[model samples]
Target chain A: DQQVKQNSPSLSVQEGRISILNCDYTNSMFDYFLWYKKYPAEGPTFLISISSIKDKNEDGRFTVFLNKSAKHLSLHIVPSQPGDSAVYFCAAPLDTGANSKLTFGKGITLSVRP
Target chain B: DAMVIQNPRYQVTQFGKPVTLSCSQTLNHNVMYWYQQKSSQAPKLLFHYYDKDFNNEADTPDNFQSRRPNTSFCFLDIRSPGLGDAAMYLCATSGTGDYGYTFGSGTRLTVV
Candidate 1:
């Protein structure tokens, strides 16, 4: 079963505009959420993360909003750049255990047009 | 710079042949993980090592095995590769606590 789901397979946005990627999970035990950006042929790079205790977390142009009630989270990029075009993956652990083994969504390919 | 490194960016192996992928980390983290990612799919956890202890996913096939002799190095051995086994293999490392994982570039495996 897919515990985490990214309903959107792809997204397109103009440069200097805002880009929003959404993810949802069915597991209630997941307390931490993370977003990772991946370029073609490269490993995923960590972007932003949010804990269950917080509703939102921001880092520079990237912001992650979490809603425990909905079991959903989103990544927002303000003034999106061409460099931001890549596959974005949302991940969370199965439970709040010591292993921290992550389960990832299918991922959304973000295209930022210059 | 301290990072996770995967050897052989690409590999082509014959069907039913044995192949091994190597990963080494300079981060000296306590945990190392192996992930398999098919085209346009998210990375799937295969196994991991917490220091000297190894943990395998329940669904991981018996054809796949892993070894971590020390903190710095890990290996993924495919006893008999199948066409369906072709995918990108990623290596990652992380320290205990609430830290994000560091992933290697990934090795693309192609079975012929």
Candidate 2:
């Protein structure tokens, strides 16, 4: 069973518009969630993270919302720029205590058109 | 700046041959991880070393092996590469926890 799920394989948004990427998880034990962005042939870089205690966390144009009750989280990129096009992944630590080994969702490819 | 470095960005090996992918980190983190990612799939954890302790995932194949000579270097050894083993191998490091987890650019492996 896939613990972390990114149901959408890809998303496309016009530049200057809002792009929303969604993720869901089967493991409610996960207390923290992270978002990562990867360019073609490059390693993924951390973008933002949200604690389960909070409903939302925002960083500049990027915002992450956690709905614990729904077992869902969404990453919102406002005024999405063409540079924002990349593969996005949602992840959570498998063992909340250790917080090292992560369970990742199949990434969503975001395409921001200029 | 501190970073994780992977050698031979691309590698090609014949089926049934042995291959090794190397990773080095300047972050001085205590934990190192190896992950395999196939096309459009999630990156799967193979094994990790926390200091000198090695932990292997139950699903990882016996053909996959890892070596951590010291704090700075880690290597992934594939004993007999199969066509199904073709994928991108990513190396990552973290401090005591996952907060500063950093990943290398990954080495794309092709088993012919």
Candidate 3:
């Protein structure tokens, strides 16, 4: 069974518009969430993350919102640029202790058309 | 500068041959992880090392094994690879206090 789910396989947006990618998790024990971005032939880079204690965290033009009650989280990128086209993955640690290791969701491919 | 480095970038091995992939981290993070990713799929954790303690995922195949000789180096050894083992292998590291992980450019393995 998948612990994290990115039901949407892909998302397309026009340049300078807002792009929203959604993710859901079945495990309630997850208290920390992270988002990663990847380009072709490259490793996934850390984007942004939110502790369950906070409902949202923003970094530059990227914002991540978490809804613990709903077991869902969303990433929002405003003024999306062509360079933003890549795969986005949502992840959470299996536990919040010292041995925390992440469990990733199937990535969502984002295409920003200019 | 890359904090994590994976060697060979690409590797091709014949069926039943043993292969070893290496990863080194400059960050000196306390934790190291090995993850396997098939095409268009999520990265699945195979194992990890917390300092000298090695932890393996329950579902990881016996064909796969890992060794962490020290704080900065980790190795993945495939005893006998099969065609189905072809995939991108990723290495990552994180400090205990940090929630975000730094990943190395994966090594793509092609088993023939």
- Report the number of the highest-TM-score candidate: 2
- Please identify model 3 stretches exceeding 4 Å from their true place: none
Q: lDDT by residue for model 3 over B9-94, one digit each (tens)?
A: 99999999999999999998999999999987999999999899999999999999999999989999999999999999999999
Off by over 4 Å in 2: none
Candidate 1 DockQ, CA atoms: 0.63
Worst 10 residues of 1 chain B by lDDT: B93-102
lDDT per residue (tens digit) for residues A69-93 in model 2:
9999999999999999999999998
lDDT of 3 at B108: 93
What local lDDT score does residue A55 receive in model 1, on the 0 to 100 scale? 99
Give the candidate number with the greatest DockQ. Answer: 3
Candidate 1 residue A13 Cα shift, in angstroms, is: 0.7
Ranking by TM-score: 2, 1, 3
CAPRI quality level assigned to candidate 3 from its DockQ score: medium
The per-model DockQ list reads: 0.63, 0.64, 0.69
